[model samples]
Target: MSFSSFDRKKENSPQPSQWKLLRQELLKYLECFLMAVINGCQVSAPPNRTAAMWEDFITCLKHQDLVSSAALETQSCYLLTKTAVSRPLFLILDDNFYYQSMRYEVYQLARKYSLGFCQLFLDCSLETCLQRNGQRPQALPAETIHLMEGKIEKPNPEKNAWEHNSLIIPSTTCSSEASLKLTDLLLTALENPVTYIEDNVEQKKADRIICSTNVLHQADQMLRRIVSQTMKEAKDEQVLPFNLKLLAEELNKLKAEFLEDLKHGNKKYLCSQETVHIPDIISFFHYEKDNIVRKYFSKPH
Candidate 1:
């Protein structure tokens, strides 16, 4: 039977599918801009028709609260222009993109912007796809799936270096697991040399902050150890009750000086080395303690 006949016989139902839910989850997980061609199964159509479908999909996304209702022209321009500054972007095109010419255009765009590009092919068997399609409220005619199967082309790494990072996800996997797997794959792809350079700068800054915090913690420990030792020695000799107030004031001054030095110290030197020189830190504290001891003992009281 013809697809038109099949369509006429069935009631028009707009119930959402599992694929829709998966798409929503991906969008939320990425929290980034997206551009997709959301068309139902159809035979080959004119390029203009495809463009119209894209516009309709954008409208539907807004209605479903999936995206904002920003001006279409400005939004497209903004997404393209600020691709680097934005969190991340995902542009999903139909699997029917079999032509090398079409793939080349996409490759050029990714290359121009130094963006990582990966093609994810849903590798499902013909029977499996047909079975799933049969369960849909707006099921495509069996013949349509058959036609698509013949026309579909798998990604080739050697032939297309730009799309070398392609992934093939099997349809047999559970929906939730598949979504997670795809998420991980995309994250890994983001680390490709072409894209990692942009992300590495932020990572380096975070590392520096952690390293600086560790240095401050070490300084704090060194000061506390020195103060504790001095008080214990004074107590052993029963010397003026070990002057708790004086110990605290001296420790605070030493900490302030140490922190000042750390602030101006070579950050690269600190982070590259595995351990700070504990002996050097101890020596500095010992010198400070001697001055405190001398001044305290000199007082006649």
Candidate 2:
């Protein structure tokens, strides 16, 4: 139930049966691929050290107070299951999830309803929740630590290796790159006390002269550079759910209005409109900077 090169059949007109079969196969691939990766994270490998890795992991997660424990667990499982990375969806979802905040009630609600209306129902009415996960129990000081002081038996490496292999799953290459970036950033931040995240504000690189974060509307004004990039890429690839022709038609109408305004001295009206040109003035660079182009027409279309 996978698409192959052979399926790119000539299309004078696709028969209804053919369309149905193609859609079914696509649905199966989406479901199987999604489930395989999501399910892969319930890894069975016991940590090499006798101590519970979840304790250390949970401790590390707390510093990222940006994320909730339960949500983090879900994302961790997603990554574990999606052992091998490859696909555009991986970047979109993985990136979005990385920025999410998690909660224990989110987990409880998930169990109670299994995400049926978590977003539409439960989460819609929810206000920001802050739960103080108390400090992690400190491990005995490093100076007195012993490798195997506890009479605990060592974990089975053979079993772990088997589970590791069994746990390996395929994903888009971009997923691996993104995962590594996130991991490296977190690791670097933990390893260095002075590390500061670039302000999420809409400051262009050059605009960040002194790394001043005192800009007017700080947190609420934070720009999503990731979403912006995703949108640009999606537009370039024609993957956005948009009606291009309709959009162009609308723009042309807008341009006509702008032209009419410009014909007179309408410069005092709106700052945005002052620089606008005829809708047909600019051609589409897959529709990325149409608004910008409207402002400054560099060699009209």
User: In model 2, what is the error at residue 24, expressed in angstroms?
Assistant: 39
Clashing residue pair totals per candidate (backbone < 3 A): 0, 12
Query: Top TM-score: which candidate number?
Result: 1
The lDDT leader among the candidates is 1
What is the lDDT, from 0 to 100, of the residue 173 in candidate 1? 67
Q: Residues 136-224, candidate 2, lDDT per residue (tens digit)?
A: 24332332223222322222225222111111112223477656655554444334322123234522322332122222112112222
Give Cα distance to truth, residue 176, candidate 1, Å. 8.4
> CA lDDT, every prediction?
0.53, 0.31
**Candidate 1 — what's its lDDT?**
0.53
TM-score of each: 0.38, 0.15
How many residue pairs of model 1 clash at the backbone?
0
